[model samples]
Target: MNVKAQYRVGGSGLRENWFIGAGFGAQFFYGDHNRQMYFWDRVVPAYELHAGKWFTSGLGLRLALNGLQNHGVTQNGSHGTGEIYDASKWLEKQEFGYMNVHGDVMFDLMNMIEGYDYQRWHVIPYVGLGMMFTWEVPRSNEISANLGIFNTCYINESFDFTIDVRGSMVNDRFDGEQGGRSDEGMLTLAFGLIYKINYTDWNRPRWEAPPRRGPRRADAAKRLTSELRLSEYDALKKYKDDREVVRQEVAVLVPLPSATVQL
Candidate 1:
């Protein structure tokens, strides 16, 4: 059972240099393997201490200590008989807990818009991966072969070799026999989100050099100036035409300009 939360330690103006958090969560197992006392009984409340640094826009590396629990279930015979005894009373309970300690390195990639700082955190998402060492108490006490028997030799305490002890040994799932050691060590991957507390400081670079500038005159200004000059050239050409002058004089019954003016 894995319970993840949304309270990630990040902000717009403040990057999380060091973070310590504690949370309560449960793991629920799937399939027919009935091991835990309850479906969600794998109650693992854990704390993590992590450190991170942003190397580029919306991307950072985080190193953390993540710990959790792995709960396993066992079963014994019930008190009920086929046709005589009650059904529920025959059920037995077998529950055990394992400790999972991990040292994990993860990445947090943020979502950013163009021309905007990647640290701006109205809402952010992240994922994680890690390896854990899982340790659990052995259930079967019948055999001492795999578990290693307690012995003292010579002047010390020792067990009788003449007598062979026999009992039902608890076997692990991977092994066919019982009580041969059930603990396992495995790796896991985790994915979740870190809701940013502030948008300004969420892991943006501390101090950035000013952006470089290009040549001063803008393309837009040059285009507009060229268009205006083209319009003046066309107007001067029309003003020098004799037909345009007679049409303008007849339409107004006067010279086109009241005073002499440069075309």
Candidate 2:
């Protein structure tokens, strides 16, 4: 019996290999007017959902939606009396939210060099440009750019855990305050799960028929002729042996003329 091994073939079609992922993380904004760092109020809830396809082992494309809740504190100076500044009297708190819809180009570093391995970890870096739509007192939209790195660890054949770190650049009015050349972008760190929707074995073995060397009909005819010749030779030998045995038996029974007996 001949056994053949199958390998995975990297799928090139649109529907063969695809994945969808969702993640949640803390998002922080850095802007000119609000320079505070590590403020509890500054960190907001952020989430992301994306669908992507890998055209090759090294290259892929993704469309994603990122949502963020943003918070900012207003600076109000003390009265002219200058007696004392009240924390609760003048400090104003502002909160808003925004959504980003973007398309990204993904590059798989591991797959580009070493090749795709479903069992191994992959580090993918991506860059994207899109628009941010803010929902605040004065709703506004602006163009934005994003840079991110995604790390995927395969938990099974169809699922993976991912760690994503991203940086985004948007218009200065994103925080409802315009003070500098550009508004502060956001930094997001998230953890999520990826599910493979369509799994194609890019490594499946492709079987090819070996070349035929001779005509099929001629080979079959030659084989049959050789078998017939062999059978005929065996039959002739058997017949000659049987005839000699019969002759010997007859001579013994009939008692043929001997030298001492008259003719």
Candidate 3:
């Protein structure tokens, strides 16, 4: 009987290869500004929570809830760098609370180009579109276009260390100011961990087996050394017996006569 082995592929389905993450970083707004400020003065803290699923090794999608704090510089009196008519226009930097809910399409560059494997690193770039809602006092909203890149290092089967650099373009009115360009831009840098849920490996190439062989069967007649027939050998043995027949001699005359006298 021949027994063949099969590959079990039940767990490798649409329900597999999901992931979630959390991250915090700094955000810088390139918005309308006047006068002078230090580099750190225009930056704010940013936070993010995200979940994603990989449809294949090369492609995936993610939804992220990003924001909490955002910084914006507005004119309290006038415009132009260091040319503000009012002295307090430089101090009009508004620290606001906001949230950006966005969905991104991610492409794993190495995995897509080199094929799937347990790689120690992956570089993923993405693009998204979202709405930014600002809160506290007068609540407002703006449509945003997003772009980002992620670098991930392998930690184990279920987790990875990740660093993300994100860039976004929003309506200039979102920051309560109008800039030279029609859209305003923001840049953020974050670090975090990603946990994959029910991750599954992709199918691999199969190997071909060599042909099988067994021991050869043996024949009794083929092992014989001499070429003699059984019937001839038996006839020769009988002839030798017939030719060698001989008579036996006995001495009994003296013994018989003594026994008769004794009786």
- CA lDDT, every model vs. true structure: 0.32, 0.74, 0.70
TM-score between model 1 and native = 0.34
Better of 2 and 3 by lDDT: 2
- Could you tell me which 10 consecutive residues in candidate 2 have the lowest summed lDDT? 77-86
- Local distance difference test, candidate 1: 0.32
lDDT of 3 by residue, 19-83 (tens): 99998888877766622556787688878999999876767899998888765556742221334
Tens-digit lDDT track of model 2 for 1-263: 22232223344676866999999888877775345434665688889999999777667899999986766554432111233223554445555678989899998887655445668899999999999888665687888899999999989879999999999898776655666445677899999999987777555432222223557446756766777787788788889999999999999999978677678
Task: Tell me the deviation in Å of residue 118 in model 3.
Answer: 2.8
State the displacement of the C-alpha of residue 157, model 3, in Å, after optimal TM-score superposition.
0.7
What TM-score goes with each of the models?
A: 0.34, 0.66, 0.67
Which residues of candidate 1, in runs, are more than 4 Å off?
1-24, 29-38, 42-44, 75-109, 112-129, 139-263
**How many backbone clashes does every candidate have?**
21, 12, 1
Q: Report the CA-based lDDT of candidate 3 relative to the real structure.
A: 0.70
